[model samples]
Structures are given as C-alpha cells and as structure tokens.
Target: MSTEQNNIRFSRRNFLRTSALASGGMLVGFNLFTACKPEAKPAVDIANLNFNDFNAFIKIADNGYVTIFSPNPEIGQGVKTAMPMIIAEELDVEWDKVHVAQAKYNKKEYKRQVAGGSQSIRFGWDALRQTGATTKQMLINAAAAKWGVDANTCKASKGIITNANGDTLGYGEVVSEAAALEVPEDVTLKKPSEYTIIGKDALNVDLDNIVTGKPLFGLDYKADGMVYASVLRPPAFGQKLESFDDAETKKVNGVTDVIKFGDKVAVIGSNTWAAMKGKKALKAVWSDDQNLESTVDHNKELIKILDGKEFDTRREDGNVKKAFAEADKVLERTYDSPFLPHNCMEPMNFYANVTAEKIHLVGPIQTPQWTAGRVAQLLKRKEEEIDLEMTRMGGGFGRRLYGDFALEAAEISNLAKKPVKVVFSREDDMTDGIYRPAIKYRIAASIKDGKLTGYHLKEAAINSNMYDLIPNFFPAGCIPNYKVSTKSYKSDITTGAWRAPYTNFLAFAEQTFFDELAEELKKDPVELRLELLQNVKDSTDEKIEYSGERMENTIKLAAEKSNWKEQKEGVFKGFAAYYSHNTHVAEVAEIEMKDGLPVVKKITAAVDCGILINPTGAINQIQGGVLDGIGHAMYGDLSFENGKPSHKNFDTYRLIRMNETPQVDVHFVKNELSPTGLGEPGLPPAGGAVANAIYKALKNRLYKQPFIKELSSKKSEVLS
Candidate 1:
C-alpha cells in the first residue's frame, strides 16, 4: 500500500472510531493493513517517511532509536516504563535503544486515556503487543524484499533483520522501505519463553530523572507568562458563596485579580505565595443556612438507615433466613470505617491557558478524556479545541480520578484572561472535600456443626449513590446461603473512589470476622479460608468473578512465605486474602505491641496478577500499597463538626509516617494467565492483616478504623 493510502485506512481517529477495543475494555483484533497503492518516493531514513501524517505507535528514527508512547497516566504505578517495555519486547529491540514518551489525552486517537480502575496494563497488554508485532513484521518484509527472500524466512532480533543466508539489515537502514510497505494483518507474537524484557527486572525509565529532582510532576509544571491562582472554597458542604471583599487583597503585593465563580473565590497573583496570601486577605463569607450534616449526624443516620426495612439487595442466593433459624448459634458484629482524605503528597494542582481559539491544559490527572469532556462542556468549546497533557503524579490512590482541580484551573485562567496555574495548599486540599465515604458493615453468620451455614452482610453509608456496592464480595459463592444488602443516607459531602474502593473496607470487616469465627470453631484462620475456597473450586458454577485456584494459591504462598506455622516469642501474625481488579492478593502481617500501642513490624504479601511486566516495578507497587493501606488503617480518619471538617490538616488528621512503616516483602505467584491490574489489589488485604495482628497482640477487637485512638480509648477506660 502507498503511504497515503495506508494513512487513510489506519488513521488514529478512524481506527479508534471503528475498533471495538476502546480503552479499558476487552481487547479485539485490529487490522492495520487493508488497502494499498503504488509507492511514490523512497527516502533512506524512516524519519523522512512522513506518510500523510500517520502517527504510528512505534516510530523508528534514522539513528536506529525507537520511541513508544505510553497511553496512560503515570500515577507512581510504574506504568510509564512497564507499558513501553511490553512494546520493546515484541518489537525485538534492545531495552537501551528504546525511548518512552507519555502520550497526551487524545480520545479519538488513543481511544481511552484513563489511569483509573487499575485497568491500564490489563487493557493495553494485547493492543500494545500487537502494535509492536505488526511494526516488526513490516520491517522484516522490507528486509526480505531487499534480499529477494521470503518474508517468513527473515527474523528480527535486537533491531536487526537477518535471513538464513546470514544477510542482515539494521532497522534504521530499511526504515524508509518499511514505512512504504503495508502493515501486516496478522503477526506472530513472542511466547513467554522467548521474551527478553517482559519478565525481567527492568528499571523505571524516569528513575534517573526522579533521583536528580528533575521537573516531571504537575506541581513543577510552568509555562511562559503564567500567573498563580489560589482558590478559597466554601467552608461547609451545603454552603454557598455569599459575598467577598477583594479591595484589601488588591493592595497585597503581587496580587492581580480576585475572580468569583459561584461557591469559590480565586486569587490570582504573580506567584504562588502571593496568590495564597491574597486569598487569605479576601476574607470571603459563605452562606451557612443550609444546615449541612455533620459526621456525628451522618453516623447516627447510617445506623438508623441500617435499622430501617428499606434496603437494596445486591446479591442473594438460597434461603438465608431458614439457614440462620436452623443454626446452633448466630454471631453478629458491626464495623465502621471513618471517611478519609487522599492527602496526596503533591496536593492538587493544574495549569491551564484558555484562549478564544483553543484551551491548553497540563497537569497530573488519572482520567484525561473525562477531564477534556468536562472542560469542553464548561468552556462551551469543541473537544478538539482543548489540548490536555498529563504529567507524572506524586500520588493518586484514586484522588486524581476526578478532574475538579483541572477544571478550577481552566476556569481561573479563562476569567483572568491569562495562563494560570491553580495550586492547592496541603490544608486546602485536605479540607476541600472529595473524601472516602464513611461506611458501616453489619455482619451475621450462622454456625451449624462447627461450620458457617449462612452469612448476611448489611452495609450502610453516606451517599452510596457515588459508588456501586458489591453484594457478592469475597466468600460470597463459597458459602451455602449468603445474603448481602446495602442502604445509604444522603449528604452533601463529596465522596469518591479510593484505592480498592469497597474492597478496602469489606476485607477488613470480613477477614476480622473470620478470625473471630476461627477462634470460636478452634480452627486455624488460614485453614478455614482455604476450606471455603476449596468449596468454591469444587462448585459447578459456570462463572465466578475470582479464580478459586489463584486465590487459594496466593493464600498458601503467603502463609508459607510468612512462616504462618511458626511461633515467635514477641511477634504475632495475622493473615488476610482478597480479590480485586482481577488480581488475587494474600498478606500476612507481623505485629508487636509496645506501651499499649500496636506496632507493625513486617508484612509479607503474595500476589497473582498472572504475568509480571517488570518485577522491580511490581515489587515497588506492592510495597507502596502495603504501606498506604497500613497507614490509613492505623491512623487515617476524617471527621466533621458544625457542618465542617473538624480535622483541617495533618496535625489533627493523623497519617502514618516513615518511622512507623513496616518492612514489606512481596512475592508473585507463577502463572500463565493474561496479566491483571496491580495498582490496588495489594492494598485491600493489608488493613485486615494488620488489624487482625493487633487483635491477636492486644486481645481486643478493633471494629473501627483509626484504630490507634480506639485502642487508646479502650485502654484508658480499662484503667479508669
């Protein structure tokens, strides 16, 4: 096919429009080669092979260097390096010769540009491999044509094409010819046995840049002629802007303008510090007559809702009531987890330059396409007129999934009539909302013949409408009769997706309950879980959300690696296993108690995500997730009083520091199944493991999060 003809057939926009393999969806076959025309001119370098603006994913330059564009955001998950490594493996190129670039948000071109739900690698695995394989075939075909040999007889290795006769051609040498050739409709992919890069311990591409403190994060983004902006949002959830006085703020040095947008007031200045000072000087007043709910009121409302008859039945099987009635005993317990703030290290920040012709936005965001769509709607402009770019995120943990910060920046820039970078101070970010919902779980299990015959879970939350509650959580299908129901109370506090979402709280409640059940039955907790999984494995169901074998394997591996059977003088072990984002994870926590406080010492984790793209990156993700889970479970909590968050900053709202972090060891199960997500699976189980260990050490049950304070209160009451 002529380059022009190929371009028409395989243009990014048309390709994405026609293909069913949208981003974050199941993979489908894509044919890059269909129609062809006679070639026009032969340029020696592929750099000059500008075939009608065809933006092929894999680009070969004249210097034999290859560039691959990663489509997802880099949210400290190591996707930036691991994804391109997949392409390099199939393209048969040396790791050092490959360069990775972050692709901007282009839905029509990239189809789905999102970094949420831990679906980046899962959705990109097949498509990215096919991209590299097809490009390699084109290069091989070009080399074969030059040598007058069959294309099938030419093999590509390390950016070179070789024939049976020992004749060879560098990928750079045949780039022009390759670009003129038609893409292969079907190409062979390398088997795991033949991979040289996929399973290896490849270092992160940005490691050097990060180590040297290079400017790569959204907080470090800067543009020429850009001003700084700080916004003062409503003090309370249901409150609205009443009035603001900016005359005094205008007198502040470097202050430019004070812009108001409904519930927010933005202060623009020559620098970030000045903007913050000017924002404080505005002394905005907000209307507080809406009678917004407080945390204590919400908790009471949740309990009242749980007591009410109204419920949404997510999943139910068999006769739970009958089984409970026939049981020898029924154990009931209620667990609560307080709301939490993401508290991302970098805080929320974004840069925007909105003009009459186009809007330019650059920042750290997990969902770029969604943000672009929102910006287009807000600005009353076409999607094409907005340019969105992503930078490396300091930390996401589901906070970046929302693009409100980016929208605020764009709004401020448009009103200011200049480029503006919206910066959120730590205090502003913490109190500005979008928090993890406070949740309540009431569990009841029927015991018959020393086994669980029936199970019922009733979950109540504030604004459950924001997130879908899963009725069929872990151990759902494993039991004979199971029932799960949910209820919610309405509130104005903004709630959003946190790491592992529902699984985070569910695992803690379910696993800790199981530990209690194990003691009641005089059986080992790990053994009891395995027994339940065995029932799932032996079941005749045609569909199961989680792999029984994978879950069982990880549980066994984690126990074995953590020395679950061993007894230590001062260490107590706790075990937990869960499945989320299509990945199975089992963790064992070793904890010690000192001075009436639980001290976590170490955590051993086993994960089954099928295949590992980069072992080093995988381990890093596991460690980070483990620490985050532990930190939040131990000290994370957000409360409201008088219609506003009582904990305004880190001082009142506790966070786990480095000195409190435990050593983490991670292990991946050996498997051949297609890869799954890694960003969140490692987290759901950590809380349960740590909480269970604390219970073992203290002989006291912790039914609420921010367990440090709970334990302290219990100890004080006992002393009194």
Candidate 2:
C-alpha cells in the first residue's frame, strides 16, 4: 500500500463502486453480488479491474475527482502518467480530477504488468481507452434516461452529460442513476486526429513526488521496526559455501543475530551500513568446485567446444555450404563481447516481513507474478500467502529480474521472525552478480561483384544466460540464403539478461561485419542496408517478422538529421544501425579525439518503438540507454583473478558520468503500428557507432571494449 506522510486512508476504494467514473461509467463486477452490492465489498470490486477495457474507473465522487488505477509500475517509462491519460481522454474528464494510483498485483486481469520488455504502453493503449469509452457511453445512456430523451441525442464531455433539449447532468449527480444501468457493449473510439491526451507532451505525474523524495522507491520504503540484513555468498562462480566463522561478525555494532540459511550467512542489524560492516567481518570459506575458475585460459577451452558444435538452429536457408562454395569471395570475421554487469543505480534490496499467514515483499522487480510464486515456494507456503509489491526501479536493466535476493530476504524474515531489509553492498553486489553471457560470434558474408549474395551467422555463448528466453529471440527471416545456428559453452558463472541480451553481442558483430562489407564493396552503407531491407509488408498478419525495414527508416532519418556529408564542421561523423527488441534504431555519432581519448560531442538517434505513448518519456529512455551504451563501449570491463573479481565499486568499475555524457538527440519514426520495445533497442549501436567513428579518424579497427587508447595498427600488438 502506498503511504503519504499524512497516513490517511481516504474514500478511494469506497467511492469506486458507489460513484460514477470520469467516463460516467460505473464499475462492472466480475461477480454479480459485488456489481450490485449496496456500497459494500469495495475491496472485492477493486480487485476485478477490467484490464481489457480502457476506461477502467474506481470513482467520481461529489467532489468531481476521478481515481484511475494504473497496473504497470512507473519505472522511468512514465506509465503511471501515460496509462491514466488513456483513461482520462476516453472518459472526457479533466486531467487534474483524474487522481491516479498504483494498481495492486493481479495477473488474471492485468496482462501488461510484466514490465521487462518495454511493452507497457503497447499493452495498455487500447485496453485503458476502451474501458473509458465504454463507461462514458453507459453514463450518457443513464443521463439521457433520467432526462427522458433519446440516448443517441445525448453527448458527454468533461464528466458531464447533455441532451439536445439542453438538459445537463453532472457525473456526480448521475452516479446512482449510472450505477444501476447495464454496461454498454459497443462503444465508439476516438479517431487518431481526435486524440487529445495521447501523442501530446504531458508532464510526468510523479515528477514532483520524485523530486521531493517521496517514498517512491523500495529503498525509501519504511515500516515499523524494519531491520536491515546483508548476505555473504560464495567467493566465486560455481563455488559453494563450506563454513563461516561468525563470532567476530556478531560482535559488530548494531548486530542482533547471525542466521544461516542454505548457502548464505546473513547478519541482521539496525541499518544497511552496519549490516554491511557485520557481513564484511565474517570470515567465510567456499569449496572451489567444478574447476572454479574464470580466466582467459578457461574461455580458450570453451572456445574449442564452440569450433564445430551446434545446439538449437534458429534459422536455416538454402544450403549454406553450397552458397559459400559458389561465391567468388567469402570473408569470415570472429567477434567477441565479454561478460558484463547490470549495475543498476540501486543495488538489489527487498523488504520482507513474515507472519504466520502471509509474507509481504516490497522491492524493484520486473516480473512480480513470477517472484510472487517463487517467494511462496521458498517460504514453503501457498501463492496466496505471499504478497509481492513492486516499486519504481532506480534502474532495472534486467538485474532486478533475479528473485534470489527476495527469497533470501523472506527466508531471513521467516527465520529471524522480524521484518528484514537485505541490501547487498556495492562490493558484494558487483563481485557476486549475474553477468551478461561471454558471447562469441562468427559472421561469414559471401560477396559476388560488389554485392552481398549470401550471409551466415554462427554464434557461441553461455547457454545458461537467457536459457528460457532464447527460443523467442532468434532472428526472423530478414536475410535469404542464410544459415544461423547457436552453440552453447556453459561456464559455472550465473549468466542472465542485460539490456538487449543476446542482441547486444549479435548486433555488435553483425553490424560491424555489415559495415566492413559495405566498405569492401565500395557501396554506401545506408544504401546497402536499405536494399537488404526489401520485404513485402503483410496486411492480414498481426505479427510481422523483421526484414530491417524499420532499421532502414531509422538510418535515413538519422542521416538526414545529422547531415551525413555536411556535419557543420568540428566533428568526425560515424553512423551505425541495428534492429533488436522488435524496434529498429540507428545512430549518427559526432566524436572528437581529445588528447588520445575519444570524446563524444553529440549523437542523433532514431528509434521506432511503435506508436508514441509519451513522446518525452520515450525520448528520455533512448537518450539514457544510448549514454549507458557509450560508457560500456569505451571503458566498461569486468575481469577475474585468483578466483575473485578485480573491480567491485564505481571507483574501480567505470561508468559514464554526467560530464562525459554526450548531447543525445532522440527521435521516433512516425508509425501507426503495434508498440515495440524501447528499453534496450538503442543500446546495441552505441559501441559500433563510436568504433566506426574512431576507425574513420585513426584508419584502424577497434577489436575490444574499453578502448581508452588507440589500438596499434600492427596485427600482433596487444597489452595486458
């Protein structure tokens, strides 16, 4: 439950059922009794939010305020504001009168609560609007009935209903009348040109709250007697805990007790700092099992397995061997990207309080439904006994998807028998983390007379990362006569999604190779990409596969905006394009080599994430994600030595600070299609754009990440 400082439980729930909504529509209970209940069972009715409808309403009381419920968490995407706009616009109600609230977790109803893929707006766009329009029509019918006029002659506007006879009725006055009517089945939707709420720039609803430091994030979550806890895990990947000497840890200030659960030894304390201090004091030993090693040597051994192996084949076209054999020239380049950390601004932390019946969980999470079930299983209880509350994330980037932190917190609370907030220290969080898979890609392109005749991509990476989501990520048929396959070489290291997942490595390799091909063929890179993007758009199909059409669009836009040839001077221009996460993105990077360091001056980015929900927010995501990609490209690396990670904190692990951030210009391709993902699409090109620019400036190719210095043109030059 969201708490303000005043701590007043208003009539938000009670007014939902008994009052009319902004659309002048009454609540339709999935249950017959709740629908007809006389001002009772507000709680039950609140749970039955019709997500399939757009004008979902809880209340419009005599005060002329309408409360809108938003199911998707506002983790910087601004869904908390944009989603309610769908409701308000359809309801024809004043924006200020529409008081919004974070919806309680419900899977059977809210289809878009799974927030990882950047589908919040796409999922909620129609549902919320239809809900509002339906309810509004119903309210108009009720008002017309009360005025004794034809319903067709009645129109609703700004929470008021009027008939041709000049009889006007406010929604508040017609609440009792509207609640008694049967819901309208058919409703008229607003035309695109008629959209007053969507496609317009609106201030984020929580801007003031966020700026004021309201209790919006899980870290800011407070409760009575909330004790902080910290966990000590294995020293390295695949290693298990052998034992721990907790005597000195228990003597630390604010130490309450040391508890052991499975592999972790947690120190419960009064604050996060004390809990971390106590965790550091504990001397623990881990069993170095499974050749517990992370080194270039181990990766070399893994690369051997990748040489000729094959796992699941995503796409296979005309005989790849025959295509390569018939071609005049076939060039193959092997590319690699190392394991990376999520490094969300807020580290993993969750508050859990266990009682005899239920366990309450609060934190930043991508999939609450999945976490809720896992929490129940970890606590050895039913799903109903575990309640998960999701809050705004400081930064998710696919890290909060890990539910182990929540499980640990719940387990500690269950054993210690108190509310425990387990916050992982920066060192602990960095060293012990789920890294982006160490990926290797081999790209082979067959050229015939300055044209790419055939294309084949063979990739090898740790299968353990994104083990479940791989089937869904394989590229669609965008290239003909192409063969694509994957080989898995598992490391004991826990690998998971970071940004665009496999596409991060795939894009780097594919785009880089594609750029190289364009240069060798002496054809314009943008023009070559446009030729490959030729595909027939399907009219009857709902799901369209990739043909790089959107990618072509983005590249054209970026080139036009960035003035590809005439860059206004003082900038070395570089261009890169990538299609991932169902959206296509292209970037033109303006860079300057300053004292042997490549510094970005500006970037013109074009993205197509489908229809714009909040234009400003989508732009913000593209800008932020692009800057993040810039940092990782230039100087972000994580290495291990002697069974321990080399970098643990920001002082060691590098990030692009505010001063280093380039001027990012974000644009969305004008399209009237299904909303695609934006959370990670922009990230894939940041590296390639910078590399391409550097290549142009220095006449050399960059083969590695963290390119702080120029790579020697000599083939055998390398540094430790």
Candidate 3:
C-alpha cells in the first residue's frame, strides 16, 4: 500500500486493476474458490486480508472458514494438505476452519511456482510465513480499527482478535470494511515457540475429499456437451507420420470425426469408449525412419566416448594425477543405469476450449502459469486471455514438468474448433513418455593404508535429455582431492527429469565407489565419511559443503535405529547417505539373498529437513521414494531396438510391487529451521543404499544397474 512499494512492484494504472480484482466480487468462479462455493451461509470474513502485491491468500467465508490460495499444486505429494498446515499453524486457525485452493497465475505474488527440484519449501520457507503473517496482521488491524483501538492492544489468535478486556470480534465481522482499507505494511511474524499448528501432526486438508471420492482429480472434471477424443501416435520413437488412408476408419459406428493433425490422427466420438473404438478402427501407415534408435546402443556409445575424452570438470581438487601416482593402488570400474518412464497412474491428459480471442484449459500440470503462456503462444493469443485451472494429479514424478499434453490439447481444441479433451491412452502414455536419461559413469579411486588418498571420477550421460547440475551440487568441497568430470551424449530417445534428476546417477556412482574405497581402507563407511565431511562447513564456505552437523545427525540416527553394529540373523545391512535441497538423509538397507535374489527385507532411514511439517507425510514420502528407486534399479528399463522402445507397458517395464516394498522405518531428527523439501530428497540414496547392500552380500561388484538381475543370475553366486 506504500507509494514507493507500489511504484517499484506495480504500475500506477494497475492500482485500479489490483483494487477491482480484490473487491469486484467477480462470482464467475476464478476456480480459486474451488468452483463449488456453497449457495448459503458460510460465515465469510468481515474484511479481506491484505498481501501487499500478493494475491488474496486468506479468503474467509461468512461461516468462519478460511481459504488459502496456494501457488504450488497437489499431485499426491500432499502439498494441498501440508502447505495449508503451515499457514493454519502460523495464522492460529483450527484445521477444520481451513479450506485450501490452488492459486491462479500472478508473477509478483509468488515464486517457486513450478514445484520441481525439491525447491518448494526451500523458497516457500520465508515467503509462506510472510504470507500467513501479512494476512493475520491485516485482520488484527481491521479488528483494531473497527473498535477504535490502537493496533498494539489487539492480538490475533484462532481467527479472532480480542481487546485487553477479552471482547472478541470474529474475522467475518470486519473483513469487508478492511478490504477497503490500504493493505498493511510491516506485518510482524510470530515466534517459533508460539507456533501451534505447524510442526504438529496436521492431517491432510484433502484427506476427507480424497478418501470419500469427491471430484479431486483431472479425470473427474466434467462439463456439459463434452466430447472425448483419442490420439493415434506412433508405436515407437523413430516412427513418423506417413500418408494415412482413413477409408477403413470412416465406417466405424460411434465415430464422429477423423481429424488429421500434426504428427497424429484423432478419433473423436460422443464417449470415451466410442472414441477409443474409432481409434482402433483406423489403419494408418507410419514410416520406420527412426528404426535404428536404441537406448541400449546409446548407452554403449556413451561409455565409449566417456572413456576416450574428458569433458568439463564439475569439480577438481589438489593434483589428482599426482595423488593417484602417490597412491599405493588404484582401482576403477564402470557403472550404468537405463532409461525409465514415470508412468504416472493417470497418464497424460488435458482439456481445452479454444476460440479466436481466448482459451480455457484444465489439467494436471506442475507449472500452470508457464503452461498458460505456452498455450497462449500456441493459440496465438496474449497470456492474460487464457484461463487455466490446475487439477489434482495422480502423480508427477518430474514427468509432467513439460506441458506436452497442454500443447496437444491446444492443438486438438483449435482444430476441433470446439472444447476438446485429449487423453493419452495407457499405451501412448507408456511408449511416448519422456523417460529418465540412461547414464554411463566411470570412476577411479586410489586408496592408501585403508584411507582414501585420491579420487578421479567422470560421468558420461545420454545428454540429449539432461543438462549438467554440477553448478548447483556439493562436489566442489565435500571432500579433499576430488575430481569429477561430466559429459553428455544427446540421444534420440526423449529424456527428462526423473525423481531426482542427475542426483540419482550421482548417488549410485559416488556412494558405491565410496563403499569400495572404504572396503579397501578397512574403515567403516560412516566413520570414513565423517572424517571427510567434518572439515567442510556450510554450502556458502570456500569449500562448499553440505551441513556436516545435519549429515552426521542423520547418519548417527540411522545407525542407531537399524542397530547397525549388531549382526542380524540372515540380513546383510549396508548404509548410504546424502544431502540435497537443504535436507540430510541417511539410509540403511537390510537385505536377504533368497534363492540368489536380492530381497530387501527392510530399510531404516533418518532425515533432518528442519522442523517436521508433517511427520507422517515425510515418512510416507521417504518410503515411497525408496520403493520407486528400487523399481527403477531392478526391473525398469525403456529398452529400444530399431529406433523404437521395446517396453511399452507395465508387463514389459515392470515396477516394484507392494510385495517388493521393504518394511520401511523413517525417523526425522528435530532441528531449527522450518521445513525443507521432503518429496524428492529421499530418492537419490535408496538406489545407492540398495547397491551397497547388494555388494555387501555379494562381494563381487555388480557395476551395472538392476544389480538384482546380475547378482541373481542362474549361474552367478553371492560374494559372501
């Protein structure tokens, strides 16, 4: 509301625009209100909360319920549940009184909206607290103004402010009057000890809706006179659109339209089943121009190129060559991981209604604002002319970060000249998905007196789908005398961010190699890591280091919880740990080689993401991440031959089933900061931890991924 603040953040003319947006009572359903507001009494707020330039985050209804517009989304990672809890705690509102909604696009009010790289909480930490406090202060100010009392005499708690005499005013009473006032400046935040809702076990805000099967997902979105459509894409990556004769497809019943579009043919009908039926009727021809595409051969080429050349050095330490020369002995090995599909349960789908001037879209997307801009460009309109509604996603393991389906929907809508919903069939979703890039890594370690003296490592990845993350990682100074080089080979296969991006590869290669070095040095891996990590301080120091204290706590906790030192009856335990996204995690995998098969019996993990936002939710994410990593490392591979993917379905690209999910026990060490990202930080370690466990059980190193397969081979035997 300050003139200087306004001039800096917003244009003079938009002051009216901002005022109208806040007060116009535009009931057309911005979809920020759930598009399901009750017609009757809801105990709405008496005054609106001020957020400076930020959007109206705390919208209180007449019925004493508060709605918070969260910029990020809820794609089963439980943001809808966990994010609001932070506010409800800070704002001192009852859980039952809170109603959370996804925010519309507003560049000034929000940052970190795309929600990948586990940066949600890292960026939201300061901003969200400010969000909650700004709104709370405004409410308190409103109550104070209405009572003709000084603001300092009024205190806000549990959606109400009371004077010294204990006379209270509900938030609904003065919200309208407060909405007319200038938004407050200098809102103060609460002390950590005063937090009541945060750090507490706040159940998911959407739990009831999800459990009761309300319309909480994109697949459930429906409108009147909606038609279903199916896209006929190539069965493999290299295959392309050749001339297709639709004469055989026009005869099918229930088929309405045969629309020819770029790279695909659409079969449209009155119902999903009918569209699917018509799609099956089409007999189209595709050129095998890309028949030579193969992820396997790509992997081989990457390894060859990696061995021949050295690319950019991600990190370098003291005289690596000299250190290697002085070492007593040096050992080297090559490791590989295959391409993996996200295979979200819902598959990729989007609905769009396009016109000459405007477009309306709804779908499960990670970046709603970015999608809107791209859709506008694709539709040849201004970004503001487009209205996008974010729907709950079944899953988004970094697969949906690219809005391919949104673009597809825009194309379908523009062509159909009607509101169209483009749904990728399970088959199309499986084969066409951008998968985790397959990577090839070569590592060399020089050890002396069972103490690591030097290390030289390089990773050659299928660069076509990934870029280097070394600029933002811990390789610079986590340890002494370390050299890490990175090179990427572009591949024909579409690759993208899997769960942890390059961290998965980094963890497997570095941790496994560290284990090997520890064995040679005759030192416990945990103790050895402590020796290296203890000297490095914070990421801001000259030798950028992960917080050694946090890492030590996680390792110590995992060691104790797993009863690490005691020999188990039949299970072999191995430990691996890493820090990412401001969180520290250490894991110990208990394994049993049953029938020569690496059966992960259980896992014990310790994490310190700062103050636990939701203990159960954090634990759930760790367990799920561990299971997902196992699936990727074991039976999952997007094999290709003749320039086409070999595995297109779950039957071919197998996932780790419930039977394979180990008995996971997770513990979070209490710490100082708020919460950091919990969703993805756990994934990088499971693959490495499991690999180390396999190595412990089988002494001979299995340098390849899916170690279970190689170790469990018919003729192969365990090292022990």
Question: Which candidate leads in TM-score?
Answer: 1
lDDT (Cα, tens digit) per residue for candidate 1, span 118-137: 76676666656666776778
Best by lDDT: 1
Q: Candidate 3: where is the Cα deviation over 4 Å?
A: 1-56, 105-112, 290-296, 464-468, 471-476, 538-545, 713-720
Error of 2 at 634 (Å): 1.6
- C-alpha TM-scores of all predictions: 0.92, 0.88, 0.89
Give candidate 2's root-mean-square deviation (CA, Å): 7.5
lDDT tens digits, residues 1-720, model 3? 111111111122212221212532111111111111112111111011111112235566545577777767677776777767766665667777877887756544443356566655544554455446655666678788888899889887887889987889877675655555555446566666667877767677678887999987778877776777888887666567887776666677767788988879888777777788788878888876633454247866786878686587766777778877888899888888877778999988888888887788888987676677787887778887887788888898877788888888788888888788888878888778888877877888776665566777777877432333543344345545788777777666777777777777677777888888788778888887777776565445543435776787788999999998888777788888987656788999999988867888888989988876777777888888878876777667666676567776776667788788889899889756656777877888888888888877877566677765665562444333
* lDDT values, one for every candidate: 0.80, 0.70, 0.70
What is the full ranking by TM-score, best candidate first? 1, 3, 2
lDDT for each residue of candidate 2 in 1-720, tens digit (9 for 90 to 100): 111111112122222333334555445322211222223211111112222211134455654567777666556767788777877787788787888887666654443354555555554455456556766776788888888888999998888888897888887777667777766655776655566776878888888888998988878887899999999887776677889999999889999989988888999999887888999999998886545545335457546755776456666666777777888999888776667888887888899999997888888876677777778887789887776788888887777766678888889999999999989888877888877777777778788766666777766776443422332222334444666677777566676767777666566666667777878888766676676666322223223344355666777898888888784555777778876666778898888877855688888998877767668877877887788888887778776664567788999787888888999998788866656667677888888887777777766766556666225323336442
Model 3 global lDDT (CA atoms, 0 to 1): 0.70
**Error of model 3, residue 413, in angstroms:** 1.4
Looking at candidate 3, what is the lDDT of residue 153? 92
Clashing pairs in 1: 1-36, 2-37
Which window of ten consecutive residues has the lowest lDDT sum in model 2? Answer: 1-10
